[model samples]
Target: MSDSPLFQPFDHPKLKTRNRIVMAPMTRKFSPGGVPGANVADYYRRRGEGGVGLILSEGVGIRRNGSRPDKAVPNFFGDDALAGWQAVVDAVKPTGACFAPQFWHVGARPDDTTRNLPDAPIDSPSGMPWPGKTVAEPMTEAAIADTIAAYAEAAANAKALGCNAVEIHGAHGYLIDQFLWDATNQRDDGWNGPTLKERARFAAEVVKAMRAATGPDFAILMRISQDKSPDGSIRLANTPAELEQLVTTLADAGVDMLHCSGARFSRREFEGSDLSFAGWVKKLSGLATIAVGTVGLDVPAKSKLFDSFGPGELDEVERRLDAGEFDLVAVGRALLADPDWANKVRDGRIDELIGFDAKYMTKLH
Candidate 1:
C-alpha cells in the first residue's frame, strides 16, 4: 500500500486533495421535490469520513424547465434546494474532503416519459434525442443563451455554498454532449459544424460563462467521454488528433480538469498506443484528468451496464496511476456499497472490503 500511487496527494492551482481518490457522480434520485434532505447529507459525510480526497455530488439539475426527467433528481437552484445543499457541504467539510456539485441538464431525453412537469419544454440543440430521431423543436438562440446563464448561476451558487470546486456534467449523452455530437446536433448555425472541434462551441461557451461567474481562483471540472450513453460504439473522436482539438478547445475556455469516463479505464483508447481515454486527454490537453468506469469490479467483457460483479484487484489501476496515465481514480459502485472503501484500501484491508451489489443502488447507505 505504501508504494501505491493512489494514496499520493494531488495538488493543482485551484484544487488540492490529500489523496487521488474521487467519488464519481452517480444519480441516486433520493431528493424529493428537487430538495435534498438530511439522509443525503449523512450519506456524503460518511464518504468524507471514509477518507475520499474529493467527493463530487450526484448530478444536480440546473435551473431549467426540462433540466431533469424525474421529480426526485436534486436541483442546484431555488431556496429550499440551495439550503439543502448547504447542509450537505457543511456535513462533508469537517471530514477533510473537498466537495463539488455536478451541475447537469438531461436535455431532450429519448426515453424520459416521467417528467416532473409534463408540459415543460425539452431543450435540445436540434430536436433529435438520438440519431435519426426527432421529437421536439430545435432550441432558439435566446433559449440557448438563457441555458448558458443558468449554468453560470449554478457555478456561482456552488461557490457560495462553500464547495471547493464544481463539475459540469458534459458527458453521457446529456445536454452538453448533445451539442457536441454531430448526430444529435444537426443545426446549420454556428453551434454545429463538420468536425468534433467545431461542435464544441456550445461547451466552450458554457465553460467561459462558469469561469466568469466563479472568478479566476475557483476550480472547474468537466466530465467528457468518447462513448455516449444508450450507445457505447459512438466515438466522438476516432483519432488522437481529433481528441486533441476537442480538449484543447475546452482547456482554452478555462477547464481546470477533465474527468474522462470510459467503459474500462485500462482499455487502450487508440491503435498503436497504450494510453487510455484519460491518458490521451491529459497528454493532449496537458490538464488534470480523472479516469472512471468499472473500477473495483470484476466486470465480464460484454456485460451490460450496472450488472452485479465481484470485487476486482486494483493492481492494474495502481500501475496506471503510478505511470502518470491519469491524475485521479473515481470509484462509483464500490464506494456506494461501502463508504469506508477508501480507508479500507489505504490500510491494506482488501479482504475486508465489501463487494458491489446491485441492491446498493436502491437506497443510500
Candidate 2:
C-alpha cells in the first residue's frame, strides 16, 4: 500500500483500487456512433495504466436514441455498444483498475440539434427543463416504470461487462436529477412527496430496481449534487438536516457509495459544521463517499454552475483527506488535462505538475 493518505489502497465489496485517487466521470464525446471502440478503450487504459485508483467512465446514455444531444457520447445499450464496452473492460483489467460507467439520460434537456425521433416526448418527471415552458408531458406510470427498468437493465449490462461498479448520474440537471429537484419534478403523484425523503422516491426506485438487477456483488454509486448545473441557487436540500435526510434515503435504497458533488470538497457545507459535502454525507449516512472538485486546476467555485471549483483547494483537499474528511478524492479536469496526475502526486512531482488550460476541455487528448 502507498504511504500517502491519498495514494493508499482502497477495498470495497464491489470495487478495489491501488490508490484513493479516482478519475472523476467526465464527458468526452469521442465515441462516434455511440459505440466505444479501441480509441475509447485506449483512452481509459492510459489512465488506468497511469495509476488512477478507480475510473468512473464518461456519462453513457441509456436511452435508445440516447439522452444527450451529442451522439458521440457512448451508450450502455445495444449489442454493439455493449461489445465496445467489453473491449474497454478487457483493456482496463490488465491494469488492475476498478471501473464503473455513469448511467445517464438528459431528460427534458433534449438535444433538438441531434437526430431525435419526430415528436417523441422527452422523458422527465414534469417535462419541464426549467421553471417554465412545459415542452412535454410528465412521465406516466408506465413510462416511469419503463425508465426504472431501463436503469436496471443498464446496471445489469455493467455487471455483465465485468464492471466493478455502476453509477447513476443523478446530478447536474440530468434526467435522474430532474426527478430530484422540485422545480423540474412537479408531479403530485407518489413520485413526489411532501418531504425531502418522499420526494426522493423516483431516485430511490431507480436504485432499488438497479440493486435487484445487479444483486449483491455489483456496487451502486449514486452521484448527487445540491444544485443543478445551470442553477446553483436551487438546492436539493436547503438545510444540512435535510441533506442528511436525503442522503439517508439513498443509503436505505441500497447505494454502496455516495459520489457527493459540490463546488469544492474542502468548503464547509453549512454555517455551523466545517464539514464539506462529502463529509456531511458520510457523517450523516455512514456510507463511503468520494470528494471531488478542482483538485489540480485553480478554477472558480460554481464557475460552471454546481460544478464548484477554484484554486488553493488542493492543499485543503489533501489535509481533509489526511484528516478523514472523505474516503477518496476525484479529480476531473485535472486528470483530463494530465493523465499522470496520480503518478506525479505519488512521486512528489508537484512542481512539475502542469496547470489545466481551458483548451484541454475541447479535446479528448
Candidate 3:
C-alpha cells in the first residue's frame, strides 16, 4: 500500500475497518419486493473482495408501513429481508470488509405517497415537506414512539445478523431529517423547540435507543447533511456554533460517528471558516466522521453538467486527507465506477483508477 494516511488501518472500539476509505451509501432499487437476494449479496461481496475498507449499504427501510417508498429498495427488517441481509453479511465477511445498513424512512415525500404504502397515511414532524405546505397531519405521539421503536428493533436485528455497524439515515430530507430541519419540524413539543439542540432531540432519542439495543462493539453511525435533495436550500445549522450544538447533542446521546454530506467534500462549510462539513464535525464532536462529496471526480453524481465526462483525479483528496481535515474519506461514484479503487491506490497504480461515467451507474456497482 502507498504511504498515505488514507491507506492506514482503522481500529476502533466500535469498528475495525481495513483502511480509512469507506464506500458511501448510495441507493439502488435492485431488490424486488423489498427483499435483497443473492444478487444483492454478490454485489456487496464484489466490493468487499475488491478491497474497500467498509461498505455502508443503501438506505434500507425498517419494519414499518411507510418505511420504504420503493418496493425495489431493500428493507432492513422482516424475515425474508433479514435472511437476505444475513446472506449478504456472510458473503462479504470473507473479504475482510465490515458492512452496515442505513435505516431509512421517507417522511412526507410528495412523490412517494403511492409507492410503498398507498393507503397508509404520510406523516412528518409538521405534516409538510417545507413550510406552508401540508402533505398529511402531524405525526401522533404514538406514531413517533412506534417509529423510534422500529429503529431500535432494526438495530437489534442488524446486530444479531452479524452486521458490523448500523447507520441512522438522518439526512437528505428523510424522516429523521424532517425532525432536524426547522422548516419541516415546527412542533412546539420537546422534539422541536427554539434551538438546534431541541431540534435534535428526536433523532437523539432514536440513536440512544439504538445504542441501548446493540453492544459497544456494534458501531453506530449517523448521517446528516445541511442541504436536502433538489431544493438545496435546507440547512440544519446556519453557523459553526449551531453545527457544534447540533452534532454535540446527537453525539452525547450516543452516535459514535457522523457522516457529513455535501456536494463538495472539501469546500468551506461557512464563511470565514475553511473547515469542511466533516472537518467541523470531527472538531466539534471529537468523533470520527466521514467526509463525502466528490473524491477523484470533478462533477457531482447525477449532475447534468457532463461537459467532458471528467477523468477525475485525487490530488486534492490526498492533500486534504494528509492534512487531517477529516478522519475518513467516503468515495461514492468513483468507487462505483471502479471497484478496485482502494486497491489500485494502495498498490500505487494511480493510472488504473477511472473517472465518473453514467454507464457504470446504470447498475448498482
Candidate 4:
C-alpha cells in the first residue's frame, strides 16, 4: 500500500476520502430537457459502485438560461430536475463514497435560443463580449441579489437531496469567472474595477451563501482557473504575490477546498515559486486543494487539443500526492475513458487500462 500513491486515503477534517483518486466533473450530454433520468443517475452510481473515493457530478445549471447548447447536462431548477438529481443521490450514496454536484450558471455564455426562453433573463457582471459577440446586459442589483439567493437555494437543495458536498463552478471563464477577470468584467461598480478584492466580491458572496446553506460540516469546494476558454487565454493573477492575495481572499470567503483548474497540474504558476498553482493555493490558504488537468489519460479533455497520452508522473503528480501537496486529484478524461481506472490503479491493473477516445465525450459507457 505504501508503494502506490494512488491507493492512499486522503483524510480530511470534514470530507473523508477513501482513496486519492477522484472522478472530476465531466459533462455528458445525456440528460435531455435539462432533466437527468435513471441513465444519468446510473452513470455516476457506476463509478461510485466501481470504487471512486469521491464523485463530482458534471456541471448542473443554477438558472433557467444558464444551460448549455445541448439538451442534456441537467439543471437544478424545477421539480422534475430536483427529483432526477435526488434519484442520483439515492443511487450513489450507498456506495460509501462522497458525492457532489458542480453547481453552475453560464452567465453571458448562453446561446440566442436559450436567451430567448419565455421567462429566462440574460444577465452577466457587465456588458461585455462572451464566446459569441452577444454582449451581455449589465445585471441589476436586484438581479445580482437574486442570483446569489439562487445559489444558496441550490446549495440547500443539494443538501436536502442527500449530496455530501457542493462545488461552485467558478472556473473556466464561466459566470463567476467573468467577474474575476478584468478583461471580461469592465464594470465601474463597487463589485468590479479598481481594486482586486473589489472584483472578488461577487464570488465571495456566492461562497458565503453556499457556506451558509450547506453548513460547516458539509464540504464546499471552489473550482478556479487561471485560463479562459474559447480563446486559450489566461486571466488569473499573473504574479505569485497577487496569486497569494487572491487565494487568501477566497479562503476568507468560506471555501473549504480549492480545486485549481489548469491545462497541466504539475507546471509552476509563477517564475520564482517551485510550487504549481495548486501547491501555492494550498500553501497560502491552508485549505484542502485538488489539482486537475490531464491526469492518467491519453489526452487532455478538450474539443480541439491534439491527441497525446497522459501517463506516468509528469513533473510532480505522484510526488505531490505523496508529499500531501493537494488533498485530491481530479481525473476528467481518464475516468471518462475508464470509470474503473481508480480500482485498476489500486489493484495494479494498469495494463488493462484503455486510451481515451474523444467519441466518449458524448456517450457515457
TM of each candidate vs. truth: 0.97, 0.94, 0.94, 0.93
What's the count of clashing pairs in each model shown?
0, 4, 0, 0
* CA RMSD, predictions in order: 1.7, 2.3, 2.1, 2.3
List of clashing residue pairs for candidate 2: 263-308, 299-310, 300-309, 302-308
User: Lowest summed lDDT over 10 consecutive residues: which window, candidate 4?
Assistant: 306-315
Best by TM-score: 1
Q: Pick the candidate with the highest lDDT.
A: 1
Q: Write the per-residue lDDT of candidate 2 for residues 1-365, one digit (tens) a residue.
A: 24678877877766777888888998889888789989889989988887898999998988534365576888899999999999999999898788899998888864455533445667888988787768788888988888889899999999999999999988888788887777788998888866788778889999999999988777899999987866566778878789887899999999999998866667678888788889988899999899987677765423232343457455677788888778898988777778777888788787877667666677766
Displacement of residue 90 (Cα, Å) in model 2 is: 1.1
Instruction: Put down candidate 1 lDDT per residue, 1-365, tens digits, no spaces.
Output: 75579999999889999899999998899999999999999999999999999999999999989897789999999999999999999999999999999998988888758667778788899878799888789999989999999999999999999999999999989899999988899999999999878899999999999999999999999999999877888898999999998999999999999999987777799999999999999999999999987787754322346444333558888989989999999988889888999999989998888777677888899
lDDT of 4: 0.78
Query: Higher lDDT: candidate 1 or 2?
Result: 1
Q: Sort by lDDT, best first: what order?
A: 1, 3, 2, 4
Any residue pairs clashing in model 1, and if so which? none
Q: Specify the poorest-scoring 10-residue window by lDDT in model 2.
A: 300-309
